[model samples]
Target: MQHALTKVGPDYDVVVLGAGAGGMSAAIFAAMEGARVLLVERTEYLGGTTSYSAATTWIPLTRHAQAMGADDSRDKVSGFLDRAVGNHSSKSVRDAFVAAGTGVVDALEDKTDVKFRARPFHPDYLYELEGATSFGRALEPLPFDASALGKDLHLIRPPIPEFTILGGLMVDRDDIAHLMRIGKSAKSTAYSARLIGHYYLDKIRQGRGTRLVMGNALIGRMLLAARKLGVTILTETEALAFTTGPDGVTGVTLRQKDTERQIHVTGGLILASGGFARHPTMRADKLPQPLPEFSPSAPGHTGTLHDLAFTAGAYHGDTAAQPCFWAPVSHRKRADGSMAVFPHFVFDRSKPGIISVGRDGRRFVNESTSYHLFVSAMYAANKDGSHVPTYLIADAAALKKYGMGMIRPGGANIAPYLADGYLTEAATLDELAGKLGIDAAGLNDSVARMNAYARSGTDADFARGTTVYEKANGDPTHGPNPTLGPLETAPYYAVKLWPGDIGSAIGLVGDENAQLLRRDGSAIPGLYACGNDLQSIMGGVYPGPGITVGPAIVFGAIAARHAARRAVAARKGDAA
Candidate 1:
């Protein structure tokens, strides 16, 4: 039965705020253990970054990857994570995270109806990096029927249209191969062709012709699970404050439907309200580079719960926000007023003629590195009189093939630089500089040096020629290297690329049990934080696939299990 709008000291065993991937998993798992759970989200939608991220694949060294022979182990993964984030991470937190990660992911996959399978071929950031493993580690949710979610389907952001099938024909690996064999093996190809044709026809007849998958697919599955479990999803609902006492957290105060009310969750409260990314002032103050490209993350990640938790005497750690980890993209708006993420620059490596420069019109780090590294370099460059408005220079061919070479074609709102004519395009390098109001001569020198390196298949300044995948991803057509290309072509294009963050790396510091800790390294009773809200159990650097979601679910399960045990003890004491 539906409960009334009346405000009671509503009590639940567990209350999870934010229905993102982490929150959803936590809610569902907690419910399975007989906890009366309440899940609160600011948006009507369920999926968070998982819904918008290109991180379609999970990280390597995960349990999902190991079953597929990726040679990843908890110890190796732990080592890599420690090396990446350094000593700031507590041993307790790390050990607990590693201990529970595999069990959590496996539990979600097997216990819940979530349709996820290992995407065996997905590559790690650096295939050669220590603790880095090949295929079998990164898991992606297989596409759902969509007809299952029905109305709740719209709650998720749609996949970009262009990535869908060509000519309304859904083509898989077998279908594509069969089409190629059409002329040679008429009989054999005919069977495969008929199978493919029937597949598309059925999808079309069911109005499911335009199928989009990847990370969005995973999110859809999670939402379905959450919905089936009867999770109370309140979008546009904000938790304003916390109700706590000397024992621990009593409950939470939420402002919903323009009315403020307090709900008492007796079991536990989970703060999955995400980090502060859209808050311009907070981001500018915390992150190295203020302005970011398309944050595939939802807009409501303002660290509200973080503030509330601290005010309620809860401790937090790792407040330095982590910028978006993917490549930069410039979105172009469609007629429907929707935007598409253009991933050409990151995916298309043939255009080595392009270079990313800082505000000082100087070449910094390799433009093709991870967006995290790119932002770090931007921050470093800022110390040397580098300005905010940077430029991404490309010749005519690169522009034509890549379409201003954004992560997506559809335009989305980026800050500061977008307002200051940061995206300047021109036919000649001089004209481009004139448009950008920079030193025309300095621009030319940078271009000449870059082109020289491109021709010689060597990057003396930055050592860009070292990686095989880099050459494969950056240099598509050229022999030996794709990152090195001559920029002498006419009609150049320059679109500004900025480093935006997915969420902050900083949050509540917790022990191995995922228990919230005080500044003096003491545990706060009955309080815990995970996902982006925790002081990043991985320290600061992202490790393995599902780095964000993996620990989130793991710690959530850990917290829920601990909370359940505590409840049982409390109930026995009360009876006694």
Candidate 2:
């Protein structure tokens, strides 16, 4: 199955593997520094799993936060990390990230098409923690029009279909709000009409709507900037192995289509391949029982880069408390027979009238907690496999007002879901519990308790809405306790939930400069890592919204800068 080497390409100043936000940022930064760069992606499309994300980056004490009048500082962020992540993470790595994150954002905005706006209202996941803020730590990409990519649009990875509506119409937070109230208010109806009209108009000419939002927007803008910067992008080109010399990694063996070639790289190699979430053996070794089958990550994330880096003497960081970021996901078989998974992050669980229950039919944790914390609770309660497949139970009224899991709100067609076994429906709480194989008596009692809390606007069992983080995810329109609502209506429904991962936390060990480190703590020269390919600075703790992406972009810039400087030094040494 292997192809023989047929040709040797010209050497480049830098080589970047993968085409996600991190890799693209590295390539763009290197090229901007006047280094000839080659960016290779194994998949046909760029962006990788980031396209499926919300693309919000959480970097504290940034100039953006200061600009927004938020009282944040580097010392404060350091204090927060000390308490939130503790000694599990490297102080040097955290310091480097804090120093470089905001500068990277500013540099990209100045030199590339990338742009970001501070989210003044998004709170830290642990808002009560020391140094946590209620606003301005998170930055999201501004929406971008895919029409700017022209035919190149096909090269960028599209967002997940589950994140979109009407086949391919992209919607923002405002658009979602307007959509949810389309029939209830005239202003919302006008907003919907305008959005739909634009979508259709774009679809008429492009065959797909072109207004990309969220992570898609971030990737679209970066790709456009990469092209403009003259960075050479090679898609469907797989890096088979590294070509090392006495000094360090010198090049890579790449398989482009049917032909294999050796491409020399004088600067360095940056590994930003999406992590090992889809790797079978890796998952078995890293995760708890009943390994996750559904992930929001791209299928191209097979951990090939992790293996390749290991072969080059890079060691995976194994000291983190958790191996990967967790999320509760529900799966359904599409018409095409492929499975569709939806991560219950922000939309449904925190909204009024929904509660997650264990096999014994009792609420285990606050339903409005962060997705990572929610799954952590599931893991804590999985001592006897009783919580392996928890259920997200909601009443008919909640279903009609705010859908659960893959089901859309406002009476979306549930017949297909029920028929396909993705959903279970019953006219009464006891009946639903029986269908879900839970104790009917326990469920009835839990529902009765929830009804009392809903009426009183308080959650005594778990304090769901008391925290700033909980209230942030809760439906604002709902009065009293936005996160607490009664399950009094008949026709209860349930969706089975499983532990899922958004990305891997254990990856190549690297220093603050983004240089991969060997087992003995020695740097593997010419090899760098960022994104999920590098051990997370958060040390497996979910601190906030953009922890993964913020560090990814920052370290990407760090790697590029280091490589550029090293390349210059090498050239000077040769001249001497």
Question: Of the candidates shown, which would achieve the greatest lDDT relative to the real structure?
Answer: 2
| lDDT per residue as tens, model 2, 298-339 | 877788888888888998887777889989999988888888
lDDT of 1 at 328: 48
Q: Assess the local accuracy of residue 323 in candidate 1 as a C-alpha lDDT between 0 and 100.
A: 38
Model 1 CA deviation exceeding 4 Å by range: 1-9, 55-63, 126-129, 157-212, 258-260, 278-285, 289-296, 318-345, 348-351, 384-387, 406-424, 468-472, 475-477, 542-546
* lDDT score for candidate 2 against the true structure: 0.86
Q: Cα lDDT for residue 492, model 1?
A: 71
Model 2, runs deviating above 4 Å: 1-8, 183-187
**What is the per-residue lDDT of model 1 for residues 118-199, given as tens digits with 9 covering 90 to 100?**
7545545454467655456566666555667665666765444544444334343345456656778987578666766655
Highest-TM-score candidate: 2
